[model samples]
Target chain A: MITQRAANIAFNILVIVAAVFFALEAETFQTSGLLASTGLPSKFFPQLMLAFIGLCSVIVIGAYVFRGFAGTDKGASVFEDGGAARRGLLVLAVAVACYLVWSLWSFIPMLILIGPACALAMGVRSPWMYVSLLVMSGIVYLVFTQLLNVQLT
Target chain B: MFAGFDVVAQSIGQLAEPITLALLVGGIVLGLIIGVLPGLGPPIAIALALPFTFHLEPIAAIILLLGIYSAAIYGGSISAIAVGIPGTGAAIATVQDGNKMFKAGKGGEALGLSLTGSIIGGLFSVICLAFIAPILATVAIKFGPREFLAISVFGLVVVVRVAGESLSKGLLVGALGIFLTTWGLDELNGTERYTFGSYHLYEGIPLVPFLVGVFAVSEVLIGAERALQKLDFDQTSLTVKLPGWGKLMKMKDVLFRSSALGTVIGIIPGEGAAVAAFFAYSEAKRRSKTPEKFGTGHDEGIVAPETANNATVGGALVPTLTLGVPGSPAAAVLLGAFLIHGLAPGPKLFAERPDMMYAIFIGLFIINILMMVIGLMAIRFAAKLIQVPTTFIVPTVLLLSFVGIFSVSHSFFNVGVLLGAGILGYVVRKLGYSIAPLSIGFVLGPILENSLRQSLVIADGSVGEFFNTPIGLGIYAALALTIFGGPLAGWVKNKMFQRAEDA
Candidate 1:
């Protein structure tokens, strides 16, 4: 269980790192022609936002580090328990897998597999749920293809 | 204003078409079903319906979505009354007294009050929208870039302030959302900022996919974590018994006050139905003769939040239609629908599309009336929908999101964007950050960037001239009050308490 204090500190550190990377990346942004003489450079808004985010991240890190809690929750964990963390992460993984299958192969195969994959991720033992989900997916597929004429690849 | 009656008549005639009528009813039923399901709200309902609306006529699509919007807010109270669980964030306040009344065997009366209050509030706000939107649009037509900048700043700041307990988290996410929008080529100079050599990157992150991902897919993932939870509730109490004229008259003051409060709040750029509901609930309690009865099956308790939440539908549309600012998260998605139809909502929409405008206003009035009739008939059926397991919903919602987003542009890049956004939303939400600021900031990003840049060029780097416009100054004043009012009130209350102690 990752306590919110620990999570906040870790997340803020990640934000700061990403912000720094993005800010540095902003420096690489180049423009030319008439656009180059515009009121502000292309990098101005992004860099300003990155700096603001980095500053906020630092403040969050300091608050969590010194006071041992963010102002909102005293010491709640990011996830409720190990079970919740497992289920959430697994479902997320399933979603990515579904997306990957669609990207790699085709939409139909992904559609056929996504329901069972998500159900499996959630630890569902019911056979009926899997059947219902497949039926629901088929309904969705037909509605979009037949009714809306969406060319689902 | 009366000169537009012919256009209104023509819009009303257009809605009388069989297809339009059917879609309106269908949208209502779908909205109610989605609203009865916990973790699904008006925004998700609208998001999921967006793809289907692509094939619809503009008026028909807008009407269908309007039906869904008004009814979904009303539908949430069904679950709130039938069970302790609120079907939507807007219905959270209804859970306290609504469920208590349900448990006490006065469920019929509770459902009835909620239904009545919702209709009354929804209709009142629609009337207010009809009158106020055109006037506001007329005023907004003259707003320059500096005024727009001021408005955008006010919106972003207000959303961050009201979003959560931690101001920094809200600002961080809001800034991040705006930052994400800066990825595409700059609109002004056509400079590629972060395209990374991909054609899909030129347009930046797509709005519909990102929004659906943030609201729907993120919720689907979160719902999966609690998939094993089951619900079993008494179906006998789902029947709605609407209040008599006398009973309605008795609660007229509450209805009127909540509707007005909700409309006012909804007109504020980023404040939403949930905030309005909670505020109305607290106000009802504060003003009640028997405040102690509020959480204990009080009828006024159910009425206040239900009315306020439904009222926000029309109120929120004020800013959305007139200013293109999106008055709520749901309105944000509705804005996506407008963009999908190649119509930009703002002062120009009213001028260019008066028929469409009239269609929306008239269609909303009809939707509210139909919602009452449909809500009463369908409450029992919707209550049964509450027991549907999360296991079924999780996979189905995920699948729908996949198919719907894929159908939008047939691009896997968009699907990837949707998935990425969902992950981001889930992570932030789990960590107790409100998604409102992030979503609103995303909507406001283009306007903020364009206006700020334009204002800077116009002012020639003079900081004092930035506040030159009267509208800009007025907006800034309102922003300041919104930011400082709560703390100032708290300080004054504390001082008074201390003085009393001394006395």
Candidate 2:
């Protein structure tokens, strides 16, 4: 339900905080031993970028505060509706969950689950859709692990 | 610009091979299929196909990928004309006139015009690439770190300016992309920047995984939002009726102008087919005696954008092949393919492997000609792809990306990086930021960092010394004009408008 105005302001504010924090972290960057005196310090590029990012982020925040929008898209909603937000977030969760499943167990279970899980997250009620997804996952397994011999460990 | 006879012979021999020919055809077909589907574009299509390229010869692999690249851009018009939803961003400009024509019972004519315009555009750019690339390579061979720095800055700035409406958001993401590259050990000095105590990250983020996640996986998340809806388009009127020479002659100026405009825009780093399409579309409209006919199914309307979009393929490759700087986002991903094959795309590639360079030039020319035949045959099937549910595509693409990244390396960490990058892409995209600048920024980051630091040392820390070179200074001047020109022009136009009203 948040308009793009609120989102841009919040996002840019966070970006500013992160830029300052990371710029501070760049101070810890050092080249030890023989590389100590090599050219510019490693922190040079990162810190420069962080400062530029911070400056840009502040402008973005300022625009939102003053004009009620950061860009040309004025007072727009972030999502089309509550349903779209729910589905998008849930699909994202399914993706993360699929990755965790692979990391925790093995690629096989994750492969079998990823498609069905994603379909379910998108609110598919059709068993045929689930069945089609599982079949696709099977094809994927064969193509990569069997035919291509990628050893998807 | 011709290479030695032996180099051409070698390239032709390899291209004539049964496997390479088959892959070329297969690449185009696959590209058409993927491009017909909404939410998938050239970059993602190429990224998904990168894994399968491992087993092929270098030329074959490259041709396969290039086939995908060229065909994918062209393939987008099929869905755009038929379904009104563009299959790729480059096809968006085509949709307005294309769909209107289709709905007016001229679907076949619209498709044919797009097809003809695309082929003409693609072939025109290939010729330009062949003539122009060698000269550019020869000149670029003498370029130093400062020149590269200018090119990198030019590329990043152009992308940021065009990618989105908000300058600040684009800059933020562009800076973020560059900062991420600051991870891993510094190449200049053996300094660990942001490895975060992981041995795997010592080399920093892998390019293929990051790009795939950004384009493919993020699209998957976005597609998931409306997966329940099934796409439908008119199955009738799907036949392609190409324009005759009489009709073609009437719009020859648009074709040539759009091709040239597209090629020039393509040569500019970070400006992509999509930008070229929109630019050419607008230019055509502005120049037209019947400007009002645009967006209502004018044949020239269909021709201009389609031609420009496909022309960008060749235009984009010029900088990518000769300069190692990608000309577009898909070219950025294509650069990753070159890296995978132990080939670095730069001026040195032209000198070291003239055969490979000739192969690309010749192969792309063949691809354009072949697209005319194959595109017509595949139009019916491609139209059906527009009908596939988003739910089906979401899972298939997500799985493909997950497996595709893992297939590249057997490491879990690479897959993890893919997911992380995908999430980042999704978040930013949802926030109304275009990922073009982010992707290009990531591609150019290392070059920018190295060149800046190296030039700093070479100049003895004098900022003025960085632009001492004639080429570098010229580039900076162009960059300056590109940044300030639009605002200045708009201001003048506004003042003139006000004066007219006052009078």
Candidate 3:
């Protein structure tokens, strides 16, 4: 089980890295000579934001490192249990897969597959649940396609 | 300011049109249905419906969103009373006394009291909005870059401070949100910062889809986490019985104070219905003779939070409509709707579209009155929505968000952005960070950037010139007071008590 403090510290480290990378990238922004004479360069705001985010992230990492907790919950586990983690991570996987299916193939397949896939990921045992979800998918399809006249290819 | 009386008459006539009236009713019903579900609040409700408003006239579109905003705050109390699980954060304060009263067989009475209080508070705030918005707009119209920079800074700081237990975490995410907006072309200079060679990146981000993704898609992911969770509600205790004249008269002080407090709090940038509700609840408890009875099925406990949460609807619109600064997270999403309609909500909005202003003032009043009738009628059925299985809701909502985003622009990139924002929001939320500051930071990002740059240009590198304007200085003073006053007062009080004890 991952404690929230460890997870938060890790996330803050990633934020710091991202901020530094973006700040560096910002310095390479293409600018016209005339535009350079404006009040501030394009890199100015993004770099300022990056610096602020970096400062905040460092503060967070420091608090977590010293006190083992910084906010909200103190040293709680990231997920409730192994089962919950499995269920949550599985659902996230299913959501990502559905997105990929839609982008790669077609919306129809993704829409049809998403409902049952998510329910199965959550370990649903009831057949009626799947049936109900299908009906809901149908309703949504009709509402968008027929009523709203949206073309979902 | 009152020159819009004729325009007000015209707006009333326009609001009576069949389609606008139907959408108004539909928005409330939809609001109640969505609001009754645990974990889906006003921001999600408004975000989900924002895309469809693309085809609507400005008046009808805004009114639909307003109807949802007002009723969604009220609908949360129904679930709070019935299930002890607040449907929205705004109703968390009500769950203590409201659910207790329901358990004691006073559910109908509790429902009635909340409904009546919500209506009264909502009406009170609408009156305040009508009277105050124009006057503020009149002053705001004269504001330059320095003043806007002050307001934007104050908004971001206050939101971060109030949003979470750890200010650093909030600030980090808030900064991240603003940084994301610094993508595409710089409005001042044509330099591309983070576009990464994509034409879709030209707009930085499509606001409606991004907001929808933030609020709706993220909620779907969270709903998936507890997909197996089931709700237990007693249907026998679902009927509403409104408080009589005597009960209302007896609690008039609490009602009035909560309304006033909620409105004032709502006018402040980034403070939402939840803050107002909690503030009113605590204030009510402190002022009561039997403060100990507050959490134990007290009437004032139920009324104070319920009233204030609803009251925040009108108060939130004052800043959102007049200054282009959203007062709440829900209003932050609403700013997306306004922009979608190509109507920028600022002081110039008054001169550009007095008809729209009239529509909102009049429309909000009607939403409050109709919310009473619609809420009372729908509460019985709407309360059952809490029982809907998250197993199906998760996927269904995901589909809705996907389809909705795709329909908005016929682009797959937006759907990708939706997914990205959803994942970001889920991770951020699971880490115990509030999304309020992040969303507000995103909404206020361009303004913050533009105003700061313009102010710097005007100031010619002098820091003191940023506070030259009386309004700018006043706002900064208020920000200072908000930041330091509570802790300072507490410190002084402690010292005085220590001196007394030593003596």
Candidate 4:
């Protein structure tokens, strides 16, 4: 099991990185004249938020370093077992695959990707589940294309 | 208000169409199915339904969504009673007594009690919404930028406190959400904020796709991890015996008090149905003659939490419809549906779209009433709905989400945004962060920014002037009291306990 201290440290690092990136991005806005005349410039809110986040990241990291971890009971790893991690990542890969297919071929290819991809990810040995998934996908296709008359490019 | 009755009547007439009625029934049935399925709650249900509403008329679309919202909360109770696992977060409190009763061979009674309580709570909250929303809207009409900013601050802070155990974690996620909304061109100056020269980025990330991605796709990824685990449960007797008027009359005080408490809590910005349910459950236990029977499957225990949770549906809608600040995560998604239909929810909504108001009021009333009848007829079918294999549901829901998001914008870029948000939501959720604050923050982002900017201008850059408004001051004081008062009181209690122990 991954300790809460390690997780908090990792998350804080991510937050700090994101905050710095946003702070740099906020530098592009030119605060002048009417924009400045409005009492606050457009960049003020975003910069303030970025700074607040950075401050909070520091606090979290310090707390983790001092207190170790807050709620160890609920701090179980997402990957409790190897199989769970594999199945989970596989599902995500399938989603990415579907997106790729949609980008290349269109909605039809995406629709086709749904059943086989999810079935394979879930490790469904039963042919019946696949048949049902196919039928359900077809019904969704008909509903969107025929009844709503949405042109799926 | 009476002068607008004709328009209200016309909108009511439009909803009475046969097609609309059928859709309402269909939505409730579908909602129950989604809710009963473990890991899919109201937010996911609504997100999945968003694309289907694109071709619907405004009234029908809203009615369908409303039906789904109400029924999903109620549907969660079924799984809680049958199995120890709560189907939704709102049902978590219901599991203690409900599952106990089930194990005691009184599953039928537990289910019936939950059903009755849910309907009563839902109806009570709808009545509260109908009465409170207009009054609040009327008051909101007088609000300036300062007041709006105060309200937004109150919302964001309250949500951050209620969402997670760690306040910093909640605020961190919320700030991240708001910052993500700053990607498009500035509406005030037309200067690009973070639009990386992409035309799609010009509009910023679209709300519907992003929401669908966050709620549905994230769950799909999580669901994939545990899909192979079989849910084993024996259904010996599935009979439902709804309480008679005499029994209900005996518990009328509990019903009324819990409903009222639920509604009031719902009206608060961040505390949602789950909070209301737990609070009401604890209150009921505290007041009961025999509090020891609470987790041991007492009828009042079931009624209190079940009623409060269902009633929260109506309570959560008050701010969503009147102020555009969703009182819950589910309401946030519903708010997205409103934006999709070009309806900006606020005080002007009442003045400009009285018909829409009437539609929601009447439609919600009908949804609650119909929920009772439908819930009874569908209970057996609803139980079977949970038995649908995950293998089929996973692909079907994914297809729906993919097609739905695509149909809304007809843009592949929006689909990409949906996937991105899904991955982000999944990652954050796995890391022990609650999505409630992030979702609510995203919905409240523009309002927060616009109001803060406007308020600063109105206050002439004086920080003191920003806190000058009595309403704003009162709200901030109340928020401060809520956040700090808890820890202070806890400290005093601990000291007192130590002294007592020494004595």
Candidate maximizing TM-score: 3
Report the C-alpha lDDT of model 1 over B235-258, residue by residue, as the tens digit.
Answer: 888778898999889878889999
| Residues B1-503, model 3: lDDT tens digits | 87556898999998999999999999999888888888889999998888788778989999999988888888889899999988899999999999999999999989998888889899999999999999999999999999999999898889998899998888888887788888888898888778888989988977777777778877887777688888987889888998888988989999999999999999999999999999999999999999999988999999999999999998999999999999999999999999878899999999899999989989989998899899888888998888989887788878888888888789999989988888888889888888998899999999999998999889988777756789899999999999999999999999999999999
lDDT (10s digit) by residue, model 4, range A88-130: 7888899989999889987777787789879898899998887
lDDT of 1 by residue, A17-89 (tens): 9999888888988887877997888888889889999998988888788887665688788887888888899
Report the C-alpha displacement of residue B149, candidate 4, in angstroms: 1.5
lDDT at position A37, candidate 4 = 58
Task: Return the TM-score for candidate 3, rounded to 2 decimals.
Answer: 0.99
| lDDT of candidates 1 onward, in order | 0.90, 0.91, 0.89, 0.84
Candidate 1 regions exceeding 4 Å error are: B1-3, B496-503
Recovered native contacts, candidate 2 = 0.84
Q: Least accurate stretch of 10 residues (summed lDDT) in model 1 chain B? A: B1-10
Q: Which pairs clash (backbone N, Cα, C closer than 3 Å) in model 4?
A: none
**Model 3 clash pairs?**
none
lDDT of 4 by residue, B73-110 (tens): 88998888887778888999999999999888988888
What are the per-model DockQ values?
0.80, 0.80, 0.80, 0.61
Question: Candidate 4: what lDDT?
Answer: 0.84
* Model 4 CA deviation exceeding 4 Å by range: A1-4, A30-39, A72-75, B1-3, B491-503
Kindly provide the TM-score obtained by chain B of candidate 4 when compared with the true chain B.
Answer: 0.96
